[model samples]
Target chain A: MQREVMFAGFGGQGILLIGNILAHTAMEEGYEVAWVPSYGPEMRGGTAYCLVVISDRPIGSPIIRNPMHLVAMNHPSLEKFAPMVKPNGVVVINSSLIHIGSDRDDVDELLVPANDIANDLGSIKVANIVALGAFVARSKIVDFEVLRKCVQEQFSSKEKLIPINMAALEEGKKVAQIK
Target chain B: MGKILMKGNEAIGEAAIRAGCLNYFAYPITPQSEVAEYLSRRMPEVGGVFLQAESEIAVGNMLFGAAGCGARVFTTSSSPGISLMSEAISYISSAQLPVVFVNIVRGGPGLGGILPSQADYFQATKGGGHGDYRLLVMAPASIQEAVEMVMTAFPLAEKYRNPVMILGDGLIGQMMEPVEFPEHLRTEPSNKDDWATNGMDTRKSSKPNLVKTLFLNAEKLEEHNVILKAKYDRMKREEVRYEPYNTDTDYQALIVSFGTMSRVCRTVIDDLKAEGFETAMIRPQTLFPFPEEPIKQAALKESCKVIISIELNMGQMVEDVERSVQGGRPVHWYGKAGGDVPTPEEIIDVIKSFVS
Candidate 1:
């Protein structure tokens, strides 16, 4: 079986970073993985996106036109990629930045206030992690314990920052649990 | 260590180190600048030299100088930068030195946008430089394969005393994937000391070695060209590499593709099989020493009716495919050339149309 996740947002939203984390998690789980980024001239504040492909078999193409899931951190990303997600796929919207819904009932759409959740836990930078937590909790594409360990390893160098990030993750997971 | 997740660009940098290549002279260009970004710091820590040359021209000449001195050297660039280095490439080939050049190709006729492209197929497999010379070119589809190729390239270059290029598209350079480097089994060419200008004291013989591309006499130049032709012919006889997919099954159509484009074709083949359509593919691992015989035989399969050459370029590799098939099968070409890779769905549609 194979599943792909497209993470889209404006640059500086750590869209690529979270995609890296997911790919890393999948690798740790012994799944074949590939992370493809749309690397254009945009370094900051411009559109940034990445796709992570996880598979039980060797991955053939890292490029995907219709991904299995999407984590849209901004409204433009939502409008651009939401419709392209496959049926029964989970669409996670960062409700903190995007006020509108995906308006599609064919799939599971989880509205997550990631930035707000991160801010309540002390920093808005962990907002991507919050969205990641929500996505993983809903899709179960990866084990939550494995993801938690992956997140811990991601911030292992910065020991003090791990708690707030952990708190943001839990808060996001809580949102996925609702409705 | 176990497998580490790394970007293709950085993995290539480390692969060079593992292969015992010490000198890296390069100019940065996108979708591949990360190699320089990676090696800049890592090289010093490993006691290797990493020089950011003023231009691709300087980088190429620097490779010539270092490789002449018997040091393993390499440089990475996208399309236009490679063009700047082409002059030096030809000179190095004429001088008969071992060096490695990597082209993480971006779309181009000139200064094209920085995105994945295979348009450099002709520029690489054919001589980009103005000479009767060819680079031993290997195109890698995945980061792991890229690392293996980079490591193998040094030995291959040294063995033939010719430039070897690791040709990858922008995606191979920009994407991140897991890689475990093969053990360093690369040994210095047994004959490098015989011709390299490493200094009289370092050589068994006392004569000073000279490295020059200029053979002013026409007869001498003709002899040089003949020797180069012999080496290329030897390469064709020995180094052709290709992977045939789904050919075990009776298939109606065959595809000839390389690099990133081949991976997309593989997906199309798999999807078509589920719908009960049988197709086969020949994924060329070596662009030079083009797998003419394998493709020729695959096209003659009783079940195969049409042959296709799919690429990211408009139709560069198609010529090679047609020449290989020799009109035994109807060869078709399908591609796009504006930095946009054709999707698997689009390819499937094309393949279905071809089959019918």
Candidate 2:
């Protein structure tokens, strides 16, 4: 199965990092993956996005026009990419910042209060990771264990922060499981 | 071999290091600046020389100086920066020095934008400077291919004793993919005792070597040109690299493209195949010593009704495609310049016009 996921938010929200971590995890799972960033002047405070394509076969084009999944971390991102998600695909949104819900009835929408969950876990910065956890849990694109490994590997540089991020992942998974 | 994900620019830097190229000098430019940035920290760790020259001109000369002294040296730049390095590149070509350079080409006429574009197709394959010369230009489609080609570039440069270029666009430089540094592609620099000017006393023959392009004598200059011509011909004969897809079967249209643009075409070809439209593709791995034979054969296929050349520039590579097609059939061109990369759907729309 081929899964193309787009992660979008502001630059400082670690949107690109989530894409990278997912790419790494997918590759580790023996899938071909490509991560492409939307790079330009708009990357400052404006909307930043990265596309991650994970496929069992060799990936052809890294540029995804309509992704199978959308992870929107902010209002702008949700508004921008929500409609572009393919019908019968998955849309995971951070409801803490995005008040408007997706109108599409064909796709599955899993709304997680990512910031609130991350804050409850201690830090709000890992909200992206929380969204990622929610994504994997609801979509089942990757296993919870694989997502955990990805979180550990990504935060390996700052060992102290690994535990909190892992906690964020757990919180995200719990909320997603209920949905 | 474990698969590690890395960006194309950083992978190129790592590949150069793995290939045992210990000298790097370059000026930063967007879409390709990461190569220099990665090497800045990496070269020091590997005991290699890394310098951010004051300008691209200075970087080109630094490459010339190091290459003359028998160092495996290289540099990276985008379109405008590459223009600045053309003079030194021509000199290196004339002097028969082995240097490797990567142009992660961006859009141009002049400082166009930082986004990916294959505008440097003419500048790279054709002689950019004022001389008859060719850089064995390699264009890699994906990050892994970029890594492998970069590793192979060093040995090819030394074997031919000519400047070798890896021509990529912003997509190839920015996209992240899984890559492995194969042990076999790792090569040591050949001993340059014969011609390198690494202190004349270091040679067993006790002879001094002067590396310069200034052959004032008419006969000597003619002889040098003849030698370079022979090398280029040999490269054409032996080093033409390309990949063809769905060419074995009869197809309605043949699409010729290179670098990252070809990947999108591949996806479109698959889509067209599913939709019952016969389509084939030819992706050139080497832009210089271009795979003209394969392209011509693909274009000449009996079922092919139209030949389309897709590029990121305003049809720069299409000229070469036309020459390869040799007017046997109509050659069409479609492209978007100044940092706009066309989507598979966009290319599909173009292909539809050809068939319909």
Candidate 3:
């Protein structure tokens, strides 16, 4: 079982962080994982993206032109990557920032107000964690408990921010369930 | 051992550390700059030396300096920057230094774009620098292979007492993959007492050890080249690596590819198999040795009618394929240069036309 996912947004939107968390969770679960981020001059304030591939076997190619899942955090990301999602794949879009919705009928689309959920949870910066929670709840690609552990491990050094991010993830899962 | 999800550049750095490379010197170049960046952070943690040299030339020279001291050393650079390092590479090869250099290739004959390209095949295998010297060029198709190759390169260099090169393009340098660290990290051999310029002890006879490539005598230079040739001969016999895919069947065409191009070729071959066309691929893992024996044997098969050489460059490895086939079969070349990687469809189209 090989799944290719891309998390895309502006540099500060924590797209890379989300990809890293997913990759780490997959690794912890004893799966082969690859997390590749876009570098070069395109990574400053411009649209930053990372490709994560989780597989039961060794990954052959880490560069993916058409990913199975796309988590779009902004309008530009939604516009750019929504159409590239594979048929029968899933797309989780942030409704608070993405102005347009995907028109494809072949794939599943989940539009969550991740930013609103994070803000409601008292930290707008946890929007990415919210998106991560929504992705986990809807797709079940990885266990939620494993993902939470990965989150804690990622933010373990920063003891204070852990609770807020955990709250943000729970809030995201709740909103995603209702939507 | 445990698995780690690492970026390609970072894996290379970590592999070097595990391979007992205690010194790394490099200058920043796109797509490959992360190698130095990763080393800068991780080297100090491992009690190794990581120096960001002012220029690629200086970095190459610094490698020479460290290797001259009989320390395990390495450097990383991209295409144009690698070109700047050619002079020092020649010197290192002529002097028979045991060091590793990584060329995370980008596009072009000039300051090309920061994208993956295999166009450096000629520059790498055909002696980019002056003189008749050869580097043991290894091309890795995956990030895991990239890490493994860097780990293996140090020992190979030490065994042959010559420079070894990890020739990867931008994709391999930028892609991420899961890698397991080697089980045992062997301590690098301490040859300093015999070869280095450390001050002599009074217990030993008074003699200075000077490492230089300047053998002004013509006959002596000829002897040096002959010794270099012998080392390369032994490497060709022992170190040639190639992977054969679906070669058991009667293939209408055989595809030769390497690095990332070989991965794309595998996808193309799978598509062709679904469409009822029998095709196979021969991937050269080591570029310098050329894996000529296997390629020649495959080409000589009566069932294999056409041989196609696919690359990211415009037929750089084609020359080697032609020599391997020895005109027994028609060897075709298909590629896109200047940082453009040929898609699976593009490669399949070329193969379809050739088979027809």
Candidate 4:
């Protein structure tokens, strides 16, 4: 029951936030989880990424060279990681921003219009939350309620942003289920 | 007592706080700068002193100043910066000062890249500075172990009245994992009047206590070295730590690695086991006062054919491996310098070539 996921995008696209939310939710669900982000000088607008590992048992190695899932939020991420997805794995792409699709037929590919869905919800910044919603809905790695709780916990101090983010998650989840 | 996801450098800083290290002096270095940044925030909350010194050399001297005042102190740096601190470290050792220094190693003969490398094994285990002394060195493979080792290092340094080190690499410093903090216990410095230069009082004593490494007499220096050697010999007997993986089986090869590099070796061992290759690893948790007896015995066994020492440096630990094996088995070395970490598959490939 070991699962590895990589969320990659430009620096301001909230790739790290998405991965951290997933890791936090997994940890809350009583699973072994680790979230590792890119460090050093390359973290500024130059392909920021994070690796999240969730397992039922203790993890052997934290470094994930081959991931079970990849969530690409932009064209560069899709171009960089789509081919590296394991056979019979899942690749969720933000179709609103990523124009390219995977050529491999061995894996499952989901193209969700994350930005369009977030814009419809009245905020373009919630696209990352939408992509996260889509991943949780399709993969079922963590419960949606637990993820929501984690989101609240992360943004608890900022009471003004909580309702909008929760609404964004629900909207994303609904769109994922319909698509 | 619960797990919290933390980076290695951040974990060490927190552990030092938990271990009752109230005074921290350090300069920023890449791959280890998080330690200082974390302490800068955390120490204030805990009523501790966290000073960002002028440089690594100044930081080491600051540690000396704090230790002289009977305060538990710590500092962290990378390769080049550690080289700058070596002189102070040697002085601290000779002065028998209790302090902890962490070296989050980066690759180098000189100003190398800001990636992980184990090239400082020799510099750490052997005498890095001009002296006949050894600092108790602990290597951590995971964030949890990093926390525990740091917590233990304070007591060990105090117990031995000498400096201790937490030697890690850039990968360990940067990597994130879950860590459990130790039971909350406050550590207070004991026996301050014994050697501390805390402002003298007339009622206490008439003599002044000076902490200095200078022994003008040749015979006294030899005697000091002998005493230091005895302490090191006792540490070798008591403090050798290692983890044995798959040692029960008739292994075709034995892999020796330590610090963050050992995690990659563990992955390689698992991969080779899936492919029907019998391999084992001897991971040294303590680099200095190394677990040599176990390695020597393992080398003498007929079941273990080849010993491979894997590191991020060219061949620093390889020399120690050769010494431990005592020429009974042919010791091989594999490494990638300048902050390059070898992949698990690359390690497996190197091991497969040795299979006779």
Candidate 5:
């Protein structure tokens, strides 16, 4: 099975970072993955996005026009990409930033207050990881434990911030389970 | 080795190092500046040289200077920057230096969008620079293939003593994929003492090796052109590489595409197969040699009626497709320019129109 995941937000929201984490997690699980970021002349606060594609077999095209799922961190990202998601795919909306839902009922829409969760964990920088945790927990695209390992490995060089980020991930996963 | 995710540009840099090419001189340009960015940090760790030149012109000349000293050297640039390096490319080719150039192509006649486009098909396969010279050009569809091609390009360039280009689109540069760099492809420049100006003392040779392109006399220049022509002809004979997809099927149309454009067409072919419209594609890995014979043979199949050249540009490769077909099949063109790559659905529609 092949799946495409889009993660989008204002630039510097770590949209591409979360997307990369997801792609790396998929790779760790023995899936072929491609992470394509919207690049060049992109400015801070402007719309920055990335597409992560995972497949059992080799991926033919990484430039996917319509992804199966979306983790939209802002309103524009949700509004623009929600309509393109395939039926029955998960659409994660950052409820902290985006107030509205996916509008269409064909897909499973989970609203997680990712920023608030990260804020409670003491920093807003981990918000992207929180959203990623919520998306992975809701979709089960990959095993959660593997994701945990990947996230820790991502910040292995930093060392001190892993516990807070892990807390933020847990909070996000909790919201996904409840909602 | 375990698989690790890498952007194509960064992967290209590492691949070059793996191929024993340690000298990199380049002027950064989108969407390929990441190659320089990655190499700048990684090179020092490997005890390699990485210099950001003042401009692409200087970068090209730097490559010439390094390669003449028998160093495996390369540079990466986008469209306009490549154009700036064209003159140097011609000079280097005439001097018969083994050098690698990568054009992670952005759209344009002049500073076009910073998105993927294969508009440089003519610039690459044909002569982008001037005079009688051709770069041995290869187009890779995936990140793994990009690594392999970059590794292989060094040896091929050294073998032919000519400039080789890794022609990728912006998507190939920007996209990140899991790549396992091959262990066996690493190679140092061979037979460098034969022609390289790497000090007669270093080689303990009596013959003074002078690398120059200034053949001002008519007969000498004509003789030099003949030698270059023979090298290109030899490459065409020995180095043509392509992948034929679903050619065994009784397909009615043949799709000739390369780079990321070929990836989209691969999906289109699969989807069409599901929908009961059989189509075949020949993805050209070597654009310089053009895979002319293969296209001709594929087009001559009894079931194939039309040969379509799908590119990201406004029909640049289509000309080569038509020439390859040689009037045996009706060759058609489908494409978009300056990025906005044609979707699989769009390509499917185009093929359906071609067949139906």
Candidate 6:
């Protein structure tokens, strides 16, 4: 199986982190994965993004033109990448900040109030994880348990932050399933 | 070793450490600055030397001094920085010093933008510096290959006593993938005791070993050129490497490409096969040798109709492809330059025109 995902957001929103987490989980599952970030000067405070391609076979190009999934964490991301999602693919949007909606009807849209959900869980930094959990729940691209374990390993240095991020993940999954 | 998720730039640093490279002097440039950044922290831990030179010019001279001592030394740069180092590179070649340098190429000509590009094809294959010299250029298509190429480059450089280059695009440096450094490929620290200028105490002979490139006599310079040409001749005979896909079948057309562009062509050929059109592709793993014989043999296949070159540069490797075929069949080119990378669909569109 092959899945290409584009995660896009503002520079400080952990867009690249989410993509990296997903790629690590896929690698743990014995799949070949590639993660390519938008490099150069524009990456400082601009629309930071990354493309993750996971496959059972060898990957050809790391550049993704039309991704099977797009996780947009802000309004401009939604405006830029929503139209590029493949037909019958999934577009997961953070509903808290994005006031506009994707006009495409052929693709599936999973709207998660990631920022609100993380704020309710007492931290805004976990919103990217919330969006990631919702994308996992909706698309079933990778096992949720593997993703959680990867996140835990990433933050193993800080033991206290793990529980809240785990809670935020569950909250996002619950919201995604209800929608 | 186990698999580790690594960016291409960081992997090059780690691989150099594994390969027993102790001295690294470089000037930072876009798309490849991470190589220097990663080594700055890593070199100290391994008890190696890592210095950020004032400029590419100074870095080139530093590399010359380090390598002349028979040390395994290397540097990384992009197109413009590589251009600045060409003067010292020629001197290093004439002195027969073994140094490995990596060029994560960007868009060229002048101070170009920091994006993935293959516009340095001619600069790499043909000598970018003055005089008669050639660098053993290896272009890798994947992150794993990039790591392997960096590991093997040290030995190859020392064996030939000539400079070696790893030519990759910005995409290869920016992309992240799973990689493992093979233990067998990790070489012991190179033995520079033979001709190294470690002073009179370390020398076995009473006479001093002079390490100069100047040959004031025209006959002496001609003799040096003949020796360099002989070494290059051996490299071509033994080290030319290329991979052929679907050439076993009676393919209709052949596509010639190298580096990341060759990976995209793999997908294009697969799609064409699914559509009941069989094609072949030749991916040159070593760009300096140019893999001319393989391209000629593939073009001579009775079923082969046309040969096309798809590149990221505006028809740089295309000239090499045409020369390889030697007018045996029609050779065409489809490419773009100045930071624009061609998509697989774009390559497919061009291949479809050839089909009709």
Find the candidate with the highest DockQ and give its number: 1
Model 1, chain B only, scores a TM-score of: 0.98
lDDT for B253 (candidate 3): 97
DockQ (C-alpha based) per candidate is: 0.83, 0.80, 0.52, 0.51, 0.79, 0.74
Poorest 10 consecutive residues by lDDT, candidate 2 chain B: B183-192
Shift of residue A147 alpha carbon in model 2, Å: 1.3
Give the worst 10-residue stretch by lDDT in candidate 5 chain B: B181-190
Per residue, candidate 2 scores C-alpha lDDT tens digits across B1-356 of 78899999999999999898888999999989899999999999989989999999999999998899888899999999999999999999988889999999988788788898999999999989889999999999999999989888999998999999999999999999999988653444576776688886666666788898988999999999999999999999999999999888789899998988899899999888888887999999999898888888888888889999999889888888899989998999998896767888999999989877
Task: Answer with 3 or 4, whichever has the higher lDDT.
Answer: 3
Task: Report backbone clashes per prediction.
Answer: 0, 0, 0, 0, 0, 0
Tens-digit per-residue lDDT, B149-237, candidate 5: 99989989999999999999889999999999877645558789988998988899999999999988999989999999999999999
| RMSD (Cα, Å) of model 2 | 1.3
Native interface contact recovery, model 5:
0.74
Candidate 1, residues B155-209, lDDT tens digits: the string is 8898889999999988999899999987754545667877799888887677888
Q: Regarding TM-score, does 1 or 3 come out ahead?
A: 1
Q: Give the per-residue lDDT of model 4 (tens digit) for B1-356.
A: 67777888999999999988888888999989999999999999989998988888898889888898888889989989989999998999998888999999987888877888887888888979888889899999888888999998988888777889888987789877777897776576666677778767822877788898888899998988898888898899989999998887788899999987888888788888888888998999988888888999877777888999998888989888898998999899998896657778788889988876
How do the candidates rank by lDDT, highest first? 5, 1, 2, 6, 3, 4
Q: What is candidate 2's CAPRI-style docking category based on DockQ?
A: high
Query: What TM-score do all the candidates reach, one by one?
Result: 0.98, 0.98, 0.95, 0.95, 0.98, 0.98
Per-residue CA lDDT of model 3 for B76-160, tens digit only, reads 8888988999999999898788889999998897887878899899999999999999999999998889988999999998887
Query: Candidate 2 at residue A107, lDDT?
Result: 89
Clashing pairs in 1: none
Give the Å error, residue B167, model 5.
0.1
What is the alpha-carbon interface RMSD for each candidate? 0.8, 0.9, 2.3, 2.1, 1.1, 1.1
For model 4, the stretches where C-alpha displacement exceeds 4 angstroms are B200-207
What is the per-residue lDDT of model 3 for residues A1-179, given as tens digits with 9 covering 90 to 100?
78988899888989999999999998889888878777655847789888888989766555667899989998888889988899988799899988788888998888888888888888789999999998888888899999999899889999999999998888767766875
